[model samples]
Target: MEYILFQKDDFTEKNYIARHEEGSKDDYDITIKGRATISHGGRELTIVNVSVEDVGLYGCRISYFEEHQNQYYHKASQKVFLDVKVPPPEWRSAPILRRYNQVTDTIYDGDIVNLTCRVPGGNPLSQLTWSGCPNGSQTDLSSSTEAVVQLQFVASSSHHGSVCTCTALQKYASPQERSSNVTLLIAHPPTLDIMASPALPWFATGGNATVNATLNCTATGGYPPATLSWVCKENSTQNGTEGPSLLSVFPYVGVDDDKMVCVCEARNSYTAVKGRVFKTIQLDAEYHPQLELTALPGNMIKEHDSVRLMCSGHGNPSNITYRWEHGEWSMAGSNQTILNLNRTDTGNYSCTGASNSSRYGQLITVQYLPITVNYLDVQIAILETNLTEGDNVTLECQTEGVPSLYDFKDWNFQSYLMNDTQLLNGTRGKILHMENINYMESGTYTCVVNNTALVRHGSKLLPILHSPKLHPYRQASQQVVAPVNGNVTLSLYIVANPEPKPADFVWTKVKPDNASRNVSELASSAGLVSNLTIGNVRESDYGEYCCEVANGIGEKLKVCFNVSAQGPPLAPTGLHEIPGRTTAISTQVQWVSAFSGGLTQVFVVEYKDEAGEIWETSASDINDTGEGKNVTHKIDNLTPATAYNIRVKAKNSYNGGSYSVYSDVISIAMKGILFYNLLNENLSL
Candidate 1:
């Protein structure tokens, strides 16, 4: 038998060998790498049995022919061994339990929460269970060690001291548990209640009152505190801080009752809770008696006027009673007092205001008196006299009154006063006799009576007569005077009733119809008068003359006088030759003057011529003296001149009512001269 073991790079092998009798079949057994092996032929190797170790190296030997040819290598075999190992089973940590806690969690009632428990570091994980107050009030969980247990219901006062717990379970190690406790505390704030006294009761006069009240409040348990306050409803102020907790308010001394409200408020620090309470207090005010007085037309009343007085007052539930002095009077209602007075009622008066509770009164006074005036009467007089130029005149005034009259006293009449005097007498009845009655003391006068009530009321007009009338007389022709040249003087006499009286004398011309002309006034003594000279007298001065006398009071009287001129008649010059067939002719005649009254009369013209020497022609008369002045004439009915002499003569009544002088003879040629008569011709020249 032979056995071998060998080593390879990554394996080992074992071989076993045996030699048998040459003729018998050889048998071999071997094990390799966990298998068993066997062999039989000498020169050939075969696996008869195998084992696990016979896998790698092998050897075999056999002999049959050629025995002893070299006893070589009979058989060969191989063996191997195998080794195996298993790993230990896997390991892991179980779940851990987590506990959560809440310290000052502030929650209101009816709030839900979930508490968690976690288990870490466990193998194969673990399961979870919730414990503590189960009763279906907490949530359940499974399949996980980290468990969340939920408190589904709210926390309440009944839930106080309760806990929510979670537990974790694993296949290894100890069980884990976690817990949280909940405290259900309700935070309710306080409520306030208020009350008041005097409670709707009526208060009368002199009634005393007292008030009593209380404030009640309640608060629930909470972490922080609350506050309560009392206040007045009207002002909304905190009563305890601003003023006294209890207050008393009074009405005016005489007022009625009223109602008032008081309030209480409550508040908390942690919760928004506020509460209020209210109460009402009733109060009645008392009254005292008072008085008011009045008078009609209060002061400074007029004379003979009347007035009224009144007094009134009021008290608690009603007005007070009124009483008047100096009469039995009592009144009710708002009008409690009264009085009616005239001038006779001008005196002091008193009134009283009274009630069942109180009384008061007052006093007053009044007065009366007369009417007045202030003036006098005055008189003025004008003495009667001739009111001629340069005459002395006097005027006086006299006033009638007990006291002397004032300076403003006035005397009035138809005329005004000229001088200041108490007694007035003058001409024209405006004179006062001061022992002598003269011509200046005659006229109308008046005396005026005056006073505050009467003005310029009394009057008297008197007449004074101390004047004479004088007049002049005249006797002359009735025609308008013709133009003449000379100085002429007429004489007349003045007659008057009062001899040697101061008078106004005047001389004037008069016509036959008695109308005067050329008036001239002069101041003189009344009597017969002489010539009133007229220088350079003309034909126009040949009219009648008269004299007049006046004393400024009555109608004037007059006397007439005759005046004449003595002068020769002069031949008329500037006569143009008359033309044949002329209807009328006018010629101008002029002459020179001789005596003072020349040409103061009428004139006559006559003419005769040869071949027809005829008796003196019919008279052609011109009434006026040719006193060296020009005068106009119109001669009619004359034939053409045939040589003629014309004669003219002056005439006057002073010369025995005849011709006074003859003019010189004048010759005129009538041949070849046309004679035109004014009655048969147009004389427009």
Candidate 2:
């Protein structure tokens, strides 16, 4: 028998695997190749250390080929195919567990990872599996390459950046496996926070304008450290090194907006475009209080009308207060005030609104005329008191003022009937009783009442219908004194039949300079009375003023008044005495000129010692140093160590009214250091 190796029924001349015939054997050299073997049994051929070049179809054939056929046919052959493959370069390092999650080269919590591992082509298809997955976590295959194992895992934070590994196992003469691991590098967008570093107050009250307002922005929690940036309204930019950035600014107070808005951006480089966040906040800006004024009831801020003022100031810490001041009067209310309107209410009113640290104020002047009748007519007139033949109808007049004269010395009241030319008695009370009434008794009646203490007066009129014989009585005004350039009134009080015409009022003035002026043009007529008003009274006006009043049918009545100066030129007020500046042995005195009698003034300062010796020196005789309306004098070389009483009075060269009543006595204690020192030296010697 012969054993031969054949290749696909064709014989090769040089290649030999194994051959044996009848106890004689030949083998492929195993020492050089190390993977091929041939047994001397001549039955088998094997090759080790497989390579690509060893793949082919082989056949074992017998050359006898059924010898009976003897036709030289090739022997019957059976064939088999041999394959050799290595483990595909160790699976290419398990495919580098990356290429997802922004290429961070890692897996993170809540990440869905698809990891592929290749076992490579080997003697049999390799096996693939995974490990390090959380307990009860199901694994699924996303897809795979030929000879590669792929697995997808849904991760959770509970995975906690643990190892995730995919392994490949090759089925060879010895099972070999390889694994690749991925440690997660979690990425997150920055959690951003922005705030005013220190809150700003609502106003700049008590604080300088250079106060720094800072805004802070921060970011944290990302794969790479986050950076912060800021943009402010003042065209400014700020940057931060790591997570937090700060921008500082100064507010312009009232010149800036009431609020400040700032924005900050935070992002991480590793997270690319998706890892960004922003935050914003508004802060209160300091400013001054803004004041507003409001009035109610109308613009007619007049006497006897209800008027109110409201002042408001707007600011932070909203508890603001308001004060309304008018000269000597003031009201305190947070926002509003109402004051009673009086004759004295016409003046500048200041409204001030204040906060804890700031204040705003404004002033307004209120002016209005009093609501009183300037005409000579009374407030009430009841006409048509009918009195005919023998019908006595008593006419009464009602007035507002309580009578302070007429019957009682201090009770002032009067009633009269004006007829033809004389004043007829109207029963002397508020009521007029007419007996045996006739057309001749009908006339106009006047009632006047007054209260001098309160400076109030009231009067009324009643017209009796008929043609009565009228009688008139004359009453002259009393003497009056007024300030220079002030007003004075004199009248011829009367009762007459017909209303006194303007021609009936005659007034004249004789000046102290012996000049005369007719003043009837300044006269006004009202019923039975006529008045002359002297305006712009001058020093020359201090003299006799006379008036002659007559109805067309009555006897003329005449009266006169004596006008005087406000006071003697030396009348002094606000008087005070002090020790002389140079020496306490004498005294210095000062006084304000209350009235200078419309002329230049000199003061008389009198001092009396306890010994009944009196000394007098005029302001003109001493120091005449003072501003207008003030008189100051110093008396030197007086008796020392003596108690003295000092008083002051005023006099004028232009008018020598007696010197005014003396000022209150001011007792002075004299200090004579020179006298005391001399006495001490004498005693010592």
Candidate 3:
């Protein structure tokens, strides 16, 4: 029998052939390692201990004897192929861990880290996994000879001093696992803080003694310990104390040392790779008080002018009080910072702070304008107000002021109801001479004095002295008429060198029987005029009256007057409208008063719409203008945006008077046009 073998890789033809003769003398080796044997009378083939190299095709051929023709022929059976598979061996060592894309074991925060784990020399690739690296993610990469696992992550302080591990396993192994690990070192910056001991406001003593303050700095949670140092204005750096807590001592702090700052700087390898960290604490050091004094509006003050003196004080632990003094007297109860200065606030002024007794002072000068000197019976250089024609006169001005240096500009003369004109062609002295002064020159003359600080105008009336003269309102032949049960004022004008006092006038009532008596409580005087009021006049009072006046410098004078029966007051005149005081709702009307006919008089203002015929009357309260002065009345509750005619009438208890002439028409617009024009003018200005 012959056996043929073919490799399983290709099945085209036989790769090996062997012949086994029946009972042949030589033994034939048919299979590898002699593990192949033919059994059951050469009908079957079996292989033990199968290996990969035994993979091939096997077949057998048998030759039969031919009786008729003695030739050898072979018959072949079907061919069979063999194949082998081997399981991987168990792991002997742990997986090897290596860092990829990195050269050092330490890394800064936020740096990307890559680590790979590999298992080499495995028939089939083993399964790889990661452990211990909770912050990183893993990826599996396997090859025919090795199993690999790579882990990538961003490093941070939380991952500092952490172990990263990679594990390897096999499927055919009996629950066996091997792991390798590496420790990660993450570097980070530290947190810094600074503080001051014994609080702030470090005080200093008088000599070389002082209250010292300590400064401390601390750095927490860093890979390497941080170094600390102090920096201040006086020094660049100072030596620090031991341990994680750093300290430096500051000695002899003074008021001048206030606002100085101490800086604490912390640095490490991590900070070197990143940035520097530091903290600062400003010093609130203090000492005794120092004061400065100043004044507003200068040290020199004019009379009646205002000034303020300020005392500025500085100190530490500051509770300072100020005191003021002038000359040898202390300003009691004046413990304030500012003192308002006045005329009495002259002489040396000193100030001191309560914390320190040192005083600061300044000299204050007071200046004043010139004042006129007065002599008896002659005020402002004039002795009388009555003058005659062609009288030679001499005027003088005398004044006194401080600082001595002064200038008397000119002498000016102003006539009654006229502008002032300079006399003596702008003279520069206090005395002014005039030849033959007349009644036409009976006006005011002014002397102007100036000291470059202020100007003064001293005036004098030049009317010469004379005897008293009477100028009654009514003519001597005309009689004053008054009504029964009415009041009246007997008024007259007079001129004299000296004004008449209330006691200088006397009045008497003379009846038709020629009886004379002094009327009690009947005389009153104002300025150069006198009045005698009579109430409830009767037929007994309608007779004659005499008024006498006298002054020490003038001869006494007497006048005769008569009183008759009742007659109405005269009508008012000069009906004028005050446009500025008039508004849409009201109008201010003023009129010149006429005679009262020797009795009390009241006014009545009447108005009417210019376009209409209806008239309205308003009775005014009895305001007797004793000297026939202007009387003012207001008309309210009038319609706006309408033209109106207004007039005033004077009435007594009698019934003989009529209304006065009408005023020019006026219109009332919204807020009046004069208000708008005045407001616009002010705005433009």
Every model's TM-score:
0.23, 0.38, 0.38
The whole-model lDDT of each prediction reads: 0.41, 0.54, 0.63
Clashes of 2: 23
Please give, for residues 625-678, the per-residue lDDT of candidate 2 as tens digits. 332346677777677677777788765555444456677777776665543364
In model 3, the runs with Cα more than 4 Å from the true position are 1-95, 100-106, 110-112, 122-144, 151-154, 158-183, 201-214, 221-276, 280-302, 305-342, 346-451, 457-685
lDDT of 2 at 633: 75
> What's the true lDDT of residue 641 in model 3?
61
Instruction: Write the number of the candidate with greater lDDT, choosing between 1 and 2.
Output: 2
The local lDDT score (0 to 100) that residue 133 gets in candidate 1 is 41
* Per-candidate alpha-carbon RMSD to the true structure: 29.9, 23.8, 17.0
Relative to the true structure, candidate 3 reaches a TM of: 0.38
> Per-residue error at 617 for model 2, in Å?
99
lDDT (Cα, 0-100) at 363 in candidate 2: 21
